[model samples]
Target: MRAKAFDTKVFKRILEYTKPYQWRFNGVIVFAVSLSVFAALRPYLLKQTVDGYLKTHDAKGLLFYVTIMGIVLLMEVFSQFYFVFWANWLGQDIVKDIRIKLFKHMLSFRMKYYDNAPVGQLVTRSVSDIEAIAKIFSQGLFMITSDLMKMGVVMIFMFYMNWKLTWIVIVAMPVLVFITRIFQRKMQLAFEEVRTQIANMNTFVQERVTGMKIVQLFNREAIEADKFSQINDKHNKAWIKTILYNSIFFPIADIISSLTLGIVVLYGGIKILNGDHFTTFGDLFSYTMFIGMLFNPLRQIADKFNEMQMGMIAANRVFDILDTKDQIQDTGIIEAPIFEGNIQFKRVHFSYIENEEIIKGINLEVKAGQTIAIVGATGAGKSTIINLLNRFYEISSGTICIDGKNINEYSLSSIRKQIAVVLQDVFLFADTILNNITLNNPNISREEVILAAKKIGVHEFIMSLPNGYDYNVKERGVMLSSGQRQLIAFLRAYVSNPSILILDEATSSIDTHSEELIQRATEKITMGRTSIVIAHRLATIVNANKIVVMDKGLIVEEGSHFELLNIEGGFYKNLYYSQFLVENNS
Candidate 1:
């Protein structure tokens, strides 16, 4: 979409952030006004020294006016300093608040939002776009206001000294303004394209870096590099458009400004030479200074206008995310610190997309402290069940309950705090093992993590590493083996001491030894908690209190492992035997 050159709604929304810093914002305005008044006074002082003191050869009077001019200059310097400092200070503070607010809002979004959103695009919105918004305050809004005020003050002094020459100078203004209007619209469009290309490049680079292993493994480096080169070129071209506009617009403005100065000098010098009483030499001198004062801000105004335009464009983008209503509602009042772990899904139906159900009317129950295993092939909605129970997604039409109370009645955080999940694809931040397990939660002590690790029988394995619990697992735990990462994930879940535990194919990818360790840890942890295990490996769930067989989003069989095995040609029986035959052959 083509961006508007000025968005009033967006500008007003940005102004709202200034509420907390009202005093500093007011200070910026005060300094701006003072600077403008002082700037206008300088030329007037020089006119008086020239006409009153110099023409009469009054040396003492010249020294006196020069000293007064020096004081006004100092005051002007002071005002300019605070104006810049406070404006930038206010901008940084507002952007810091916006970044924090945006991040916190993202944290509350449903999993569905993230499923389709690009990670790099979100990063751009949070980092780069917000930085653009800062320029609104620092270089855009306040600077434009100050420059406009200076222009106004200079114009008034020019008109007061000689209205005839002032009219000549004003003649060139309409042409400059016309050119600026056209430049403003064109530059806005160009900047919008620049921002879009920047986002595209960021997304490409972020994905490539994150999946660098796959890129190299599949010998796709040259291919990916060529793709990145294309994206980078687009970004470069977008930026060049803005640069091209600047080049064309600024020189045109300067030429118009220079031509206006020539006209003022020609007209004013002729009026003084003709011995007109209405115009004097001092008037000519001050009018020239006035032209510079007026036309300089006039030119800089266009540049600042571009800054404001880009900031508004960025604000519009940033506000789009802030205004999203897809966040999971945390309106439930119930706060159950500990759940009884009696989970039930009553006629639950869900779909990530409208009218495309993934879990079709699933009705299931697991009594307190029971171990239930769900087995199915890929796309069978097995993982969807765990997601629904955890409320990472809201069911389309259904009721889920824990301890006979509807899950919706519980506060989201309270309910989530009572359940822990360890997924097949484990994720660990780059941090010490202890921090990763505790997730830097202050309440979770180092002693507690160590104690939980020892209980799970992975303490020795951890200690065998470079620094035991202190060893840093690099980004996504790339420093550790897949099996070791799973072990760390188990320890993380175990340390939470959740009432309801879930393992979503946690052992499907690990080697025999790590699987053994995880299996033993799993048995120990599931002793008193209600557990749901979704596994492709049927062997792991043979001892489960109940086994569920699923296909095409429906429960095809439900019973203990032996009971399902005894059924002739049953779905569970066929699935179990197929896995069994594959294992024996391998």
Candidate 2:
């Protein structure tokens, strides 16, 4: 099991959710107790009729007796119904709130959070763990309440009627609590094991299915099957342990209950025989019935122990996510909404981790609406430039300013809203192409979408599809070709007309034909934007107003196409000459 650090403050946090429903919650408890009282009264009424009125056979008495019992039964039924309906309503409502908060917080965390965390575990936290909180609060908590309230009240009534019989039952309370406490501790560990196994199975399923292409490519289907089978086998054994604990809990508790029943009747029977109380058979019979009712609640209380334990484990997992602070956030004290594209990097330095720095004392200035292209080998810190501009990761030293204001001083939404990014890895929603094109811009018209697509040369192609804008992208647009997906993403980014545009390997996956078509579109998109293009193919970026060559996180060269070509000795000249020869030979 993963080590869990329980926040003692979970109850305090949970209380905030229930605070709005205090009256309704109090009503639920009142109904539960009322039902218990009614149950206790039922058996007592029979004792009165048999001991007092039945022997006389009075005509009016019989009618009164039956009518009184019917009313008590009706009240009990309604009380039980009220408790079930609204408690479940509250549980599900809390689940909704929890899911929303979890997602909101998860989205706010720094990009490094997702880069390190497992996607499978995050999915479990959102779906299964949230459900666990709901299940426990609904059926498990309410049922427990019903049993405990019923048992407590019935015991009080039993003691009032017959102290001798109540004490006999009381003698068994210590043994029951002891047995329950022992099983509860052991069962808690078992429940945690079950939760761990479920998470493992989920991770196994997600990894195998998401990487089906890799598995097939490597011919590792048998290996994946064995791994999945092992997880399932562990899950089975953990579940069986839960079952065995549950199975033994009831029976062991029942034996203690049965033993109490024997002792009560034997001691009470001896007393009646000795003329200690009353000799009538009806009195003894009702007494025994009352004791049986009390035992029902006790056994139920024991059984629900395991449920509460499982709920705690689930709650801990969920709270873990809530406890993490989003490294990026907006403190709404004040915010600026409008921005221009002017950017300055003043001795900027950063690292994804503490061990090694990627950018060292890098300083540059770019006028608004200038088109700059960055070229470098892989891992030469080309993409880090864009990441810093977007404030996805904070700078470790020095400052970045946009429009002469520190970027960190601006609202997160304000800064990001003005920036558009088209990454090498393209993604689209599983919704209609129109909605995905417009994204969350509700006020955008279809005409605007069409214009944007046409400018990017994807409009005619989109119309050729069967459903056009109404078609589902099918979970990350897997149904669409890579080049096609890249084009749509580019179109979407341009439609926003953001102040700062970052294109990271945006055209690397497209074919020669698609590349030719998109180049015209790219010129239209970058016409008046502060566009930064990170490209591998030198031919695609020759027209950029400025080209910067990077090596080992420093800007090694910066110039126009002619100036860099004339040097013939720097890194850029070597790269250009090599690619230049390949192009001429072809």
Candidate 3:
């Protein structure tokens, strides 16, 4: 378990986000102070009206006092309205800016960081943790500060009026402070446990729901429900602990408050009855009200103290993510408006994990407009090569170059803009076909997208839909068939007008007819562009200008397809024959 202690760095960072809206937050603080002063005045005014005006039966004097009290009440109401409005407004605006900054920082992280992080935990940080910080500004910081100020003012006035009775009230103060400190520590631990349990529950539920189809198909619904119940029970218990602490603390505070009020009433009444010169009926009445005002805000301050602890815990969690140094630092200064598509790999080596190289000392070259097909069994680092080419992962040794310059010398966005990829598992956003293809690229007009679709032979298929190019492809493009999704992916890449193209097992999952259409489309698109194809179906890459066969982490053979077939007992020849046998048998 992590410590529940307050972190100064996290607290200071959260405060820094409020710097942009300091003027508004300062205005809220001014109103809060005014509210405290006005609230303290109300009780004093009531005591004066009851003891002075009522006993003398002076109607005009009473009217004057009542009118003054009414004006104070109105001023208090106005102050409270502005305080609440501005406090909440400041909190929400600060959170909005923080949320946007957090999201943008997340976007810049390397893929390796996400591969190790949980989706549910990240969601909890971005949404719920930020909300907790908002409460600090609105309910925790200003509210508690105002309560403390009110207590201080009330104490000063009580001492000035009658030091003897004030001393009686002061006896309860030590007990209240001691009890509040203990309650705060326990509640902080309880709140931290609650946050952890909620995050665990969210992770479990998100994973189970996403894989519900598999669970139901396997008839594990009852078993999964039992598991969920156990997690939910832990979540329930965490919250109950917080409630138990709250239940114990507030009643104790109330009891101490009642005791203080009783002592003041008993002591002050006796002084008045004994005819003490300094003691008056009105003074005693005002002391009663004063004691209540002091204790009430103390009780509120205790509650707000709990909220502050929870907010600090949330800030620590959010800052942990912000502090992560696992980011791809883009230092490349070169910009490429167009790449000639000359690619070369010289002794490139890499590992997704330390000391377990997946690509080792591989050398390859392709001319500006050549198509090279890579044929290999799984785990031969075929896809890893493409990953390095796009700079999704850095190479551990040697160099990869495009157009005779190191790929890293060019800015990441510029390099990626001139290269496009269509993977076997196509992913599409839930959006209109037109928007999905254009991807809201301001420079790529609708006419260009339509032209690309026609050139790729997918225009007729798109127009045949009910809404033509405007048809919506629902989440993950689940509304469309696998083949239709692939077509859309192709069109999306086509409209980008990339100088280099990569097709990773592109026709591996489609039916024969769909495969045929894609094959023709593939030939047309790869005609004048540099293309790299990772093929499981040997027939798709038979006409490639060069074929490379890899096994383990090294290239075993490299030549034209037919030329590789002539090599005795070659890996490519064996792979091609094995796939051909499966097709014929099927």
Candidate 4:
């Protein structure tokens, strides 16, 4: 839903983007004004040719006037071209800047913000909504300005030709104005509905398309199609409402214009019949043309006004994102070229929601370069610990520190630079394996990436592909198998050479062979760094220096693997025996 009135603040903010390209826009405005003047002069020239040359039988004068009119027509053509070209240029440049800023702003937002905001809505704001704002500059605002100026000049000339006829034309203005007001109001509602429908449609289509495999696999295709049909039906209705309003409004405007034209013709004919010599035929002809010119712009003004209104509505939405304060505040000023990776969690507690603490009053400390493995059941806050360490979500209470300094004392980028996480679900961009590993980091060159991959034992596997390291993973790495993507994720993390490495169930879903390779790669990468392994499989983390077992948001057991296995009925020992029995049976 949109507000009924135009938001001045949003409009003003949109106009501020135009300031950078104001000179180019000024050129466009110059052309627009010239075009308007040229249009007004056309009818005036016709009046002169009709009365001054034709009535007087001056052939030479007629030829000169016609030649001048032809030149004016040529000027109009150039003016029109440059006007459109420069206006579009200005608008495009402004929106380009806007899209870049908006996207960068989106990147800065915290995970919590995205948890609630839909991807499709963000895309609409950045793409379609920005385009709407561009229309305001290129087509709506400037075009309306030119049209109003033309109408003004035409009105002045109409009064000059015949005051009585001008009054008759003026009388029709009220009716046109009334109709335009009604049309604009109705169209505003229609356009708002259309925008909402488009956002909803985008959300539906994006999500469904991304998850189309589930739809087809579950044999819910028909059901989903019906759902889509319902959404599309609403989208259809929204646009149809717009068309219906336009259909009613434009014809009424046309009728009013035609009636005014008729009145001018009738009144002029009667004046001529009454032998009024001053009311010449040429004057009446130009007056009729002027009335047409005036009403034409008046009608167009309504459409342009709607465009501006829509743009304003779009501006409001975009500004809402730009003005969002729900971002990870990078207020920490500490700079770290390298972190020793000494980490501590003291009385730390957190929740994704209020009064539903997932991690409660946990205390742990790890020496630099030590490997610690945390084993837990699902929803036991194993991954939550990693999230908190990364500051992906701020802890609700207590402190988490790195290298004896509060984690918040270092800039997020500075801290993240020294930490790398290989998640269970590996995400790879549609890019060559080399770039995927290096993430296009100039600091980590191709040679460095190859060296890291080779050291981690994935370089040979990567080279086995047709394109070697240059293989394109395609979207979400769908071209690769689950294990291959995991190996790539490992290589990507290894290449970063982070001081702190987090392997969050990295081997959970891979095949046995891939697991062996990953486990070998894991040992090499974690040799001289602080590593935290979140594993469901006890076998994978058997080599970890220390083991912490968590349950129901508290550490139930903590010790070396053998030390914990000796604890009678200990949580870790019981979980280990259970998993061992399962593995043996399988």
Whole-model lDDT values for every prediction: 0.92, 0.79, 0.87, 0.90
- Candidate 1 per-residue lDDT over residues 327-417, each given as its tens digit: 7777889999898899998998988889898988988999999999999989999999999888899999989999999988889999889
Task: Give the range where candidate 3 is weakest over 10 consecutive residues by summed lDDT.
Answer: 1-10
Better of 2 and 4 by lDDT: 4
Error of 2 at 136 (Å): 4.0
Q: Model 1: runs farther than 4 Å from truth?
A: none
Point out where model 4 deviates above 4 Å: none
CA deviation > 4 Å runs, candidate 3 = 1-4
* Colliding residue pairs in candidate 2: none
TM-score of each: 0.98, 0.93, 0.96, 0.98
| Candidate 4 lDDT over residue span 166-281, tens digit each | 89889889999988988888888888888999999898888898898999999999999999999999999999998998899889989999988998888888989999775778
Stretch of 10 with least lDDT, candidate 2: 2-11
Residue range 364-422, candidate 3, lDDT tens digits: 99899999999898999999999899988888999999999999899889889999999
| Candidates sorted on TM-score, descending | 4, 1, 3, 2
Off by over 4 Å in 2: 1-9, 53-60, 270-276, 329-338, 580-586
Tell me the lDDT of model 3 at 272. 75
Q: Which residue pairs come into collision in candidate 4?
A: none
